[model samples]
Target chain A: MKKRTLISVPVIAALVAGVLFAQDITTWIKKTAGDKPALAVPDFRGAGDAQPLMAVFNATLYQDLSNSGLFEMKPKSTYPLNNPQQQGDIRPQDGKGLALADWASPPVNATHLVFGFATITNGVFAVYGNVDDTRQQTVQAAQLLSNRYLGSPVEADAIRKAHEFANDIIVKFGGSASLLDSHIYFTSSRGGAGGFGTEIWVMDWDGNNQKQLTHLGAQLAHLAISPDGSRLAFTSWPLAGGQPQIGMVNAETGRKIPFYNQQASLNSAATFTPDGMKLFYSSSASGTPQIYTSALDGQGFTRITSTRGNPTEPKVNPKNPNALLFVDGNPKEQIYRMNSEGSGMERVTNGEGEASNPAWHPDGQHFAYAWTRGYQAGEFNVFVADIAEPQKYEQLTHDGRNENPVWAPDGRYLAYMHTPLKSRNAQIYTMRADGKEIKPLTTQGINRYPVWGVK
Target chain B: MTSEFFRNRNLTLTATLLVAALFSGACGKKAPIPPPPAAPTATNTTPSSTNNTGTPGRPTATLTVAPARIERGGSVTLTWMTTNANDVSIDKGIGTVGSSGSQTLRPTDTITYTLTANGTNGSATATATVTIISPPPPVTPAVTRPNPMGTLESRLASDLKDAFFDYDSVNIRDDAHTVLVGNAAALRQIFMDFPNATVNVEGHCDERGSAEYNLGLGDRRASAARDVLVQLGVPEAKMKTISYGKERPQCTEATEACYQQNRRAHVSAGQ
Candidate 1:
C-alpha cells in the first residue's frame, strides 16, 4: 500500500540542502527473522539500443524486489552517488556499485546493493546482475549469467532475471528464496466446459503466464502436484454424481487418468512422496479414511496412519524424509508429526482453532497451515509454526477467509485459497511467508486448492 | 486462464481442444460435461441447484444421467432432484440424499436406482439408470486408456446393494443386514457368472468428522460389510476393502439424515 516506489524531483535549493545530508542509511542489521533486509535496487543501466528497457527494467526490477517483501529498497532519489554504471569498474561478480562500498553503504542505507547492466546484441537481450554484501566485504556477491530473451517482445526482461539475484541475496541473509522464477499450481475455471468447473492452473510466482493443466470440468476436492511437477493427483467426481476418487493428470500434457480408482469410495487427498516413488493418499477403503502410502505405480500399498480420525492430507516433510505432518486428532489440528512409518506420533499445534492443510517449508523444522476459529465454516487465516515449538507461530493473512496455505519450494512464500468476507467465490492468493505482499492470482470464478511447486 | 497463453501465445492453440473434443468420441469420456456453445460465461449459473418447480410444498423428483450407456465399469453422472421434500432417499445404498444434487455413478451392470421423495403432498418417486453397455473384447496386455469402442459382457459396481452404517462406528446395523443379504446374493451371482471377477468394497463416512480418521472409520465400515457378505456365502477372496473417510459425502448437508446416509459401505467393481 505504500505506493510501490517513491520518486520525486528536487529543486536547486532542495538539492543543495540534500547534498549536505549524510548518514549511515544502509547497513542496518536485520532485527527480527521476519525483518525486511534493507536493499538498494538501482537502474539496470544499458547502452543506447537497450535504453528503451532501462525504465522497464528499473520499474520491473524495483517492483519485483519490492513485492518480494524482503527488501527496504532505497529510491532513485537517494541513488546519485551510487551509480554502478558510472565507472564500468564494478564488475557484477564483485558486488560493487560505483566499484566502491563507501559509495553505497551509508547514505543509501542498503545492506545489499542490487545493480546491473542491460545489453542487446544482434538478437539477444541480457542483464548482468550483481549484489554487494557490504558487511561481508565480499567483492563477488553473486551473478546471474543469463535470464534473457531471443526474439520479438524480444526485449530483455533484465529485471525479471534480477529478481533471481535479489532472491539469492535474500536467501544469503537467511530469508526464503522466492521471486527467482518459481511456479504456482492453483485451480482455475478459466476455459472449461461452459467456463464452468475449476481446472488446475499453473503460473509464475508473480501470477503471470497462467495456463490450464487439466480441463477437469469438475470440482476438485484436493490437489497435489508430484514432487517432480510432472503429474497432478486430484479428487473429484469425474462422472456426474459419481463418488470422489483419485485422478491423475499429466502436468505438462494435461492428459487425465483415473489414477487410483477405488469404486464407490472417497479417495480425497492424494500426494506424492518427496522421492516421487511413492504416493501418500487417504483411502476410505476401510470405512474411514486412513493414510496409505503406495508406490507411484500404485503397488506395494501400505497403511501409515491408522489412528483415531480419518487422517487426510499426509505431507511428507520436504526437508526430512523420515518426518511427516498431517491433520489428525478428533478435532483435526495440523502440525501432528509422525515417522514416515506412521509411528512416534506427536501433536505439535493444539487449541489453535481447527488447523488443517499443513505444508512444510523446504526447511522441515518450519511449516505453514490454516487455522479456523471454531468449526470448519469459521473465517480462516494462514499461520507458520515450527515443528519443535508449535505454540510459537506467526498468523499470516487477515484481510479475508484464507485456508490451505501451501509452501513453495523456497519457503518464503505460500499459496492459499481465499474467499473474501463478502463473496462466496474463493480465489487463489500467494503471499510472503510473513504474510506481507498478498497477491491474488485469479480474478474471476471460484479458484481454490493452490499448490506451489516446480517442474 | 491458460498460464501458457501468457508465457507464449502459441500454446493458446490448445484452446481449440474443446472444439476437437466435440467432434471426437474419446473426448466425451475425458470431459463428461462439454458445455453448449451458448453456455453461461459472465456469472456461472449457480451450482446450488434449487427446485422452484412442481407443487410448492409438495415433493417433486427429477432423475437423469448423461451418457446412460457407458462402457463396463465406466462412469455416468446421475443427477437427481427433489422439491419441497422433508425426506429424500435413494435405493442402491445412496440412502438419504440432498433434495437436489448430482452423483457420479460407476455402475458395472445396467441398473435403475430408485429415489423416494416425501413431503406434505405425500411422496414422489423417480428412477435413474447406471447402465453398462457392451464394451470391446479385452486385448492382451491391457492398455491403461479409455477404450472408445470398449465392450464388456459383465457389470459390477452398480448391481449390488450398499450396506449402511451408523455414526462414528463401523458396526453394520440390523436394517443394513437386509441390504447385505441382497448384496451377498449379487456378489455370489457375479462370482458364479465370472470366476475372475473380484469385488472392491468401499467404506464411506459423513462430513461431520475430521477428514483424516474417517478414512479408517470408513474402512471399518466397508470391511464390516465385506465380513457380512462373506458370511452370507460370498467368497472372502473376492472382496477387497478401502475407506474414503469423510472426504466424499453423498449428502454434503450438515444434518442427521445426511450423515446417516454418508456412513455406509458401498460395493463396486474392484481393481
Candidate 2:
C-alpha cells in the first residue's frame, strides 16, 4: 500500500477569512439596523368610528412601545384620519395596492409599517395587526388576538397582553425595546377608602408588578429621588391630626425622617442637589409652593423664590448647579428656569399652553415637559426642547393625553404617562427623542410619575 | 559418635521446649487490670466547701459593690468578701478595682453596688446597703443677679413673672438687683441645710438675630449671672451656665409681644 500526503494552504486561508468576514457582517448588521429610520404609521383606516375596544388596544400598544425605548415612534394624532373621504373613494382593488406616494410623504417615512384591524365577531372583540416592511414590500410580522371585553376589570388584563404582543413585534422588527422592567411611583385611590389618602405605588413600566410603598392613608405626593438613588423625598399630609411635614426616606432601608414641620402646608417637590448637601423644594408653609433651599442636615433654610403663582417641581440641571427648571402655576401653568440663588428667573415656554412637570435630560442640554393644549376640552400632549435653544420645541405626543415625561439615563429614550379617554385608564409610554415610533410601556392601572434609574 | 549424637538430640529437645514456652508466654500475656478505687468518705470534703462558712447549705454569700458617691470630688474605696467562697468578685461600679480586691470610685452622684461569688457547688450574689445622705445646698451669694440685656430683661419679667433685668446691659440693674438680693438671702438659708448643692444658670434669647450670634449672646447672659454669684461669695465651682439661642420661644408669634416673652435667664438647683 502506498501512503500519500496532501496539503492545500490557499483553501485553509480562504475558509478562515470567510468565517471572519461573516462575523463582521453580523456585527455590522446589528449596529446599522438600529440606525435605520423608524417606520411611520400614517393612518388607521376606518378608525374614525373605532370601537372602544379598538381605541383601548391601539392606545395600549402605542404606550407600551413608547415606554420600551426601542423605537422612535411619531406621536399619535387623535384627529379623525385627515382624508377619511379618500378611504371610501378607493375601490376594492385599490385596497390591495400600496399607497407608496402617500406613505413616503412628509410625516410618513415608510421604513416600516404597522396596520391594525378590529371587528366584533360573535359578541367578542377580535383585534389583529400586520407589521410591514415598506422598504422590502412584504409583511414582516402579523398577530391575531381576541378578548371578551367583558365590562369588568379583567378586560384591562386582556388589553395589557395585547399591548405586550405589539411590543414583541416591534422588538422582532429591530426597533428600540420597551421598558417592561421599569416601575413607576404614583398616587392611587382605587378602594374608595375616603380622605386625600394618596398612597405611593410601584408597578412595571408596562403596568405589571404593582406594589404599594406607603400604607399610612396619608395624602402623600411630590415624590423625588436623590441623584445617588439612595433616598426619596416627599410630602405627607397631616397624620394623626398633627402638623403636615416634609419627609425623607432611605430608599434602601425604608427609614423615614421628617425634615420640616409646620401647622400649615409643608410639602412640595423636594429634590437633592447633585452633591446631596442641599435640598431644593417648594413649600406652602408661608402660603404657596415657594421654592426654598435648605442644608441636607435640616439647617440654614432660606426661601429662594417667591411669586404670586406657586413655583413647583424644581428640577436641578445635571450639568449646572446654579440652574433650575420648574413649573410656576395652574389654570395656565408655564415652565420657567432660574439660578440657584433665585436670580435670573426667566420664562422658558410661552403661555400658549399649560406646561407642567418639567424633567431635565441627563445631558443637561434638553428637557421634556407635559403641555396641556386645549386642556379644557381634554387635548394634551408632551413636548421636548433643547434648553440651549428653547425656542426650538418639538411636540412629542398627540394621543388623548400624555404627561409626566422622564428621561432615561442614555438620553436616547423617554418615558411618560398616557391616558386614553376611551379606556379612561392611564399607562406609561416611551418614544425617541425625535418623537417618532411612539409605543406603550405599561398597561395596568393609572401609572404615573416614572423615574428612570441611574445607570 | 554415640556421645555426640546424644548431646545433639538433648540440645534439640531443650531448644524445642524453650520455643514452646516462649510462644505460650507471648499468647498468655494480657493488658493489666486497673485497681479498684477506694470509696469516698465524709471526712474528704471539697476544699471550697471547707473554706466557705457564711451559712452551711447556703451558697457562699456575694457582696454587690455600689457605684461610688464623691465627697467634694474625692475618691471613695469599697471592698467586699464572701465567706467560704472559692472565687469572689466585686462589681466595681464606676471605678476599676486594684489587685488587692478593693475599688476607689469617684462619681458625680451616690451610686448603689453589688457583688458576686462562686464556690465548687455554684454561685451567689449580695447587694451593698446604700444610704444616700445628700449634701447641703450651696449658698447663693449676696451679690445681685445680672440683668438680661436688650429685650431679654422685659421678656424674662413677662415670661418668668419673678425674674427681671436691665436694658442693653447684662449687669444686674439696681431694681432687679434688689429682687435678686432678697432671693439670694433665702437661698443662703437653704444652703446652710445642704452645703454641696449646685446651680445651673440658663440663658435665652429672642428671635431677632442669627442663631449662632444669639447663642453667644445667651452665653454672655448666663456667665454674667454666674459672675454675680461668684463675687457675692458663692463658690465658683457650684455654678454652671447654659445658653439656648432663640430655640424655645415663649410665644409662637412674630410680634414684639412674643419676642419680648422669649428672652430671659433663670437658675435651677441640683443636689
Candidate 3:
C-alpha cells in the first residue's frame, strides 16, 4: 500500500508537468507563427517574350511577394515554365489540379505556393494567379487581374500587376501586410525638364504612389537621408548665381536650411554620420571634391581626406562607426575604405570595371556599388562585395545601366536607379542582396539617386 | 500510534485546504481598489471691467503699425492715429512729422518712425513707417583694363600661366618673380604704345581649394602682380586687381592640362 501511494504521487506530478509542457509548446508555436513570413520575388519577366501576358503575371506576383517582406522568395529562373506544351506548366489551372502527393518533395516543400497565368483575349491582355496550400491540397486564393495596353505592346503595366499579385498573396496569408506601402525617394528628370535637372521625387516601393518632393524648377542631386529618416541632405544650386550649397530639409516639415554656404562651386555629396551628429561631404571648397566632415550643426569643419585625386561620394560604414567607404577618383574610380579621420586607406576591389557610388550594408560587412567597364554607354550594373574579403565581388543587376545601389536597412535587399539603354528615362529598381530577384520599384518618370529609409 | 497518525493526517488536510482557499480568494479578488474622492474648491468672485482705456478687462490704447518696405532708391509715407487724443507728437522720423494723433511723414532711405499720444489715461505709443528709396549704387573705381596680349607675348603668357602658388599662400616665389618681371617689361611697352590704356590684373587658382579661400588667394595673387608693376615704375593707381578664384576657369576638365591653365594671373587693358 505504501509503495502504491508513492507511485501514485509520482504519476500525478508527472501528469501535471506534461500538461504544462504541452501548453508551453503551443504558446511557442503560436508566437513563432504570429508574424507573417517574408517573400522575395526578384524578377518576373524579361523585356520581350512570346508569352508577354504570362510574363506580366509572373513579374507582378514576384514584386508583390518582395514588397510584402514576408516569405523568403526563391530566385526566379527564366526557363520554359509557362507554355502549355511544356512538360511542367505551373499555371493556376494546372496548379489547382495538382495532387498533394505530386508536390510533397523537393522544390515544392513550401506549404503555400503561387501559380500565375496570362492570356491576351481579343487583343486585350489579362493575367491571373492562384495561391495553393499544398498541405490542405486546396486552392487557397485566386485573383484575376487586368492591365491596360495603350498602343505600345511592351507590357510594362502587365508586369507591374504581376508584382502586385505576389504581394497580395503574402497579405492573404496573414503576413505583415504593410510591406507594399513604403515609399522610395529618388531623383527624376521626366517631363522634358531638360539640362541635367533632376528633381527629388517619392513613389511607392512597388511603383504606384509617384509624387515630386522638390519643385520642377530646382536643380537637385546627391540626395542622402538621415539615419533617423527625419531630414534629407542634398546639393541644390539656386537658379541665381551661387555655388551648389549643401541643403538640409526636414523630411516631414519641408523646412530647408543650408548646411554649408561657400562662394566656391560646392557640389556636395553629403551623408549623415551613424550617430547623426556629423555629416561627410565632398567639396571643391578645398580645391577639389576632396572629402570633408562637419558637425550636424554645420560647425567644426575639418578636412578628413587629402588624396591627390578627387575623392567624392563618402559613404560611412553602418556597422563600424569609425570607418568610411568612398570612391577614389581618376584612372580607376575604385571603391576605398578608410578611417573616419581619412587614414589607413585600403582598396576594396581590383576589378577592371570602374566602381563608384559605394553604399554600405547595415551590417557594414558588405557593400553594393555601381561598376562600369570604362566609359561604355550600356555597361553599368550594380555589384556587391564583402569588405572583409574585398576580392569577392558579385554582380547584382544584368540589365542596362544600373547604378547608385543603396541598401535597405534589413540588409536583405537593395534599391538602385537604372537607366535602360533603349529608354532615355531612368527608374528605380530593387533586388535581393544575393543578386537575385530584381524588380522595378518605380515605373513613372526618370528616377535616380535612390536612398532607402533607415529601418 | 493510530491516534497520532489520525492527528497528523487531519493537520495536513487542514493546511492544504487553507492554502487552496487563500489562493482562490486572492485570484477571485484581483480587481484594483477604488481611489478616494477629491475635495471641492472655491471659485473667484471678482467682477470684470471693460473699456478701450487701461481698465483691467479693456485693451490698452496702443497704436500698431506695419513694418515698411522700400526699394533702394524709393520713399514712402507712414501715418498713425489715436481716438482719444490729448497731445500728439511723433517720436521717430521727426523731420517728416511730429504730431501723433494723425500724421503723414516721408523720408529718403530707411528710417524708423515712432509716435506717442498723451491722454488722460496715460500716454499711448504708436509706430509709423518710414520708407527710403534706392541707396546709391556701388562706386565703380577707375581701374585700368589691359588689352589682350598679342602672340608676340607668348613666352610671357606661358610663364605667367605656369606659376602655381602654394595652398592659400600668395607670396611670390622666385620662379613667379622672374616670370612677372618679364611680363612687367612687356606690359610697360604695351602701355607706352597705348598711353591712355589701364591694366587690370585678374588672379586665379586650381580647383582643389574652398571657394572663399580661393577667392582670397586669387586676390593676393593679383595684389602681388600689381605690386610688381608699381615697383617697375607704373603708377600705383594705374594697376587694378580682381580675383576670380576658381570661377571663370579657362578649362573645365580634371586633367593636368586644364588644372595648369586654371592657376594663373592675367593682365587685361581698358582704353
Instruction: Give the count of colliding residue pairs in each prediction.
Output: 60, 47, 49
Task: Give the DockQ (2 decimals) of all models.
Answer: 0.14, 0.00, 0.01
lDDT of 2 by residue, B52-166 (tens): 2233322334232333333456554454434334655555443332212545555455555655556556555555533345567999879965553313323323323223443
lDDT by residue for model 2 (A153-179), tens:
234643664565665665675544344
Worst 10 residues of 2 chain B by lDDT: B38-47
Candidate 1, residue B106: Cα displacement in angstroms equals 72
Question: Whose lDDT is higher: candidate 1's or candidate 3's?
Answer: 1
lDDT by residue (tens digit), candidate 3, A252-312 = 5556765654434344678999988799987656654567888885677788877655567
State which docking tier applies to candidate 3: incorrect
Task: Please estimate how well model 2 matches the true structure, expressed as its whole-model Cα lDDT.
Answer: 0.53
Stretch of 10 with least lDDT, candidate 2 chain A? A1-10
lDDT ranking from best candidate downward: 1, 3, 2
Judged by whole-model lDDT over C-alpha atoms, candidate 1 comes out at 0.64
Global lDDT of each candidate: 0.64, 0.53, 0.56
Computed on C-alpha atoms, the DockQ of candidate 2 is 0.00
**Native-contact fraction for each model?**
0.32, 0.00, 0.00
